[model samples]
Target: MLIGAVVLVLGSLFLVVPFLLGNTGVTGFVIGFIASLIPLTVVLLTVRLIDRWEPEPKRLLWFAFTWGAAVSIAGTLLIQPLFALAAPTSSEEAFTYFMATVQAPIVEEFTKSLGLLVLILAARKYFDGPVDGVVFAFTIAAGFAFTENILYFGREIASSNDPGTDLVRIFILRGVMSPFAHAVFTGTTGLIMGFAARKWHSGYAVLAFFIGLLPAMFLHNRWNSMGQNFLVEYFVVQVPIFLVAAVGIILLRVAEGKLTRQRLLEYARAGWFTPAEVEMLATSRGRRQAIRWASSRGRGRAMKSFIKGATALAFTRQRILSGRDVHVHQHDELELLRKIPTLRAAVLQ
Candidate 1:
């Protein structure tokens, strides 16, 4: 109820803000949408592919995106002006520095990370691990960045000079040069949030949240600060962050693969899964081959659904083993079980 109320208030503000600024135009929207979407597609695909074993629910994923674009952005718009008013600045440079390096990063990263927090609070089941948290983080960042780009483009369009040059420049900066900045920054928060979720009873969720928030803010600060040459910023600052994120994601993927393998073996031993099915489901390659074999017989959809259902069942059972609430998922567990026979019938033909 709280999340819904927040969303309602913020979404309304998000819709109304443009009209107040007189910046609502089709051209700006189009340009921003195209610019933001191209990179977002790549980010989404990369995130999804990384979590090959168990994909998150699409509805929840979309909610995270919407929360970022509407609620987070709305909060930022409302809070930032207050911050500007509160911040003491002797000159324009000081004001700019205050806004960019301090206020913006704190406000924006917290707001963006709030989307993941909402998910954790409202729908903990969707977030099983670090990969799921990263997925939500990237999606939320994408949505936030998309709306920001639109606002920037709109302002550029309203500029007195030729808007085309401004549009291209803004696109190159926001869309190309630093497309993943928000994602990378906020993903640090997501990583820690995932840890908090996994270890919810460890009496350290508060500590984890702050630990994540600090790095996110620091990274955002360094990126916003114009204290270095452009090439130095790119090579010295950006590349290492990107490599660290890449390495972290790869490590998480391997961990998830091992978890899947362990779960499948456990289920096979318990008679819930056949050894053949367990072996096939333990690896990405084997899963793909299973799908291909079913596709060759025109049962691709059924086989795919079956595989997904089996995977969910394994994860669900693991959750039960971990003493998480299982009653809420009773229906889902039964449904997946129901699909297994139909999936087999369709695929075995």
Candidate 2:
């Protein structure tokens, strides 16, 4: 908690200093910040949906966001200039193109992915599977997009001759059309790291990070390289990619639900939970019905807590099976086991 507070404070400074330095006036900054939240909210809601099965720790989620919005963005800003210094004294247009297509994708994805690595190394117990990976990745991407949108919106508002017209145009383009671009790009890395977390040791998980960067960098490069024919490329290439990603996420969510049921069945065999309780805790419809039943008895919150604890128990079982860090997960397993019966009693009462 103390570390999270320190990161939040430092991240806030890193984010604010850039806008201040850019002379994005107070009006522009405020308007930009407000406009940015519209899409940020949408992105976060989508992430919440993906993460519904078993939520990651809130502190880690916040860390992912801050890393993207502040640390990753700051790293990109600092490194890209050094690349500029090394590049040949070429035409301005060519340099801009190179930076956009090459430098930004490489630098941005690397920095964004570093957040995932940090979580895997520092908080391995929570970083369980691919869905968790996508959740964290999407969160970090959301934060980055939020910050980037503010800068784009504020600069457009401040610099454009027709702020109203340009604001509408840019908002439609960035806010409505391509808000998930960053998430899609960085999610590749997160997905890979997540698989690594489940199957491999920490050292191999580090290797997985670089392997995942391949697709992330490629997708980012493709998106930025679309120049004059933005509409054509967007429809032909980007739309299909986004559709594929969405479908993949849906499939992963279903898999997560199934996995939760399967894991809890083991507990049922051990008498920690009944088979009926596993069914109630694992399925969407079952959970909803359980909640409604609990609410009718004025135990809605207790039911919710019971469901959450049971879900955590299932995932802790998963971590144990994976053999990544058995000793640590064993402790969590015992603790959850101890807590679950108390939570269940509250729901029954």
Best by TM-score: 2
- What's each prediction's clash count? 0, 0
Q: Candidates' TM-scores?
A: 0.89, 0.94
Error of 1 at 32 (Å): 2.6
- Candidate 1 lDDT, tens digit per residue, 1-349? 5567565757756564564256737666566556667667766777677755588878887777777777788778778898899776798888888999989999999888877776776677777567778888888887787677777776777662888898888878777777788889999998888877775543444466667889999999988885649678888878898889999988987777667778778867867778888767767778889889888888888777777777787777667666656675666677777776777676776
Runs off by more than 4 Å, candidate 2: 1-16, 19-23
- The lDDT values for all models are 0.76, 0.88
Model 2 lDDT per residue over 208-270, tens place: 899999999999999999989999999999999999999999898888889889999998998
lDDT of 1: 0.76
Q: lDDT at 178 for candidate 1?
A: 76
